[model samples]
Target: MTENTQHDVIRRNPLLEAAQEEMRKFERRENEFRRKDREERAAELQLPLAEIKVH
Candidate 1:
């Protein structure tokens, strides 16, 4: 393929960029529920919060 054709094929057009942003937003929303802090996990599991904090 010509250089211009190859470049065109690989270009990040607006639609593709918008689609990618939407996917990122969806992933972040899903991860918000999937990911939990230590306190949240303890509360969910009905366990006492530990006094020690681990980084």
Candidate 2:
């Protein structure tokens, strides 16, 4: 194995790993929020309303 490859594998160093995890979690949450917003908008658009006449 090359020295560079070994170095890359051993370079996690705790802080970097935590940062990467946080970033991944943030991205996942953002995607979920976007998907939910899209679904809600679609549902709203598809809703039907009826009007009543008053005397």
Candidate 3:
């Protein structure tokens, strides 16, 4: 048997997985809010809304 570094192997980490899930949820909600805000602004000015650029 041989020893390997952490980054050299794939493993399941519950804590990291949970944190990633939370970030995904946050991003989805933020995108939704940005979409609505853009739409409302466009409506106020009588213009088409532009596409949102997600980072």
TM-score of each: 0.47, 0.59, 0.65
Q: Rank the candidates by lDDT, best first.
A: 1, 3, 2
Q: Candidate 1, TM-score vs. the true structure?
A: 0.47
Clashing pairs in 3: none
Deviation of model 1 at 43, angstroms: 1.9
- lDDT preference between candidates 2 and 3, better one: 3
**Candidate 1 lDDT, 1-55, residue by residue in tens:** 6999978867858679989999999999877766566668878888755665644
Rank ordering of all candidates by TM-score, starting from the highest:
3, 2, 1
Which 10 successive residues of model 1 have the least lDDT summed? 46-55
How well does candidate 3 match the true structure in TM-score terms?
A: 0.65
Which lDDT value does model 3 have at 49? 45
> What are the Cα lDDT values of the candidates?
0.76, 0.74, 0.75
Where does candidate 1 stray beyond 4 Å? 1-12, 36-42, 48-55
Worst 10 residues of 3 by lDDT: 1-10
- Supply candidate 2's per-residue lDDT for 55: 22
lDDT of 3 by residue, 1-55 (tens): 2345554443546667888999999999999999888778878988744564535
Across residues 1-55, which tens digit of lDDT does each residue of candidate 2 receive? 6998878767856768899999999999999998677667757887322332312
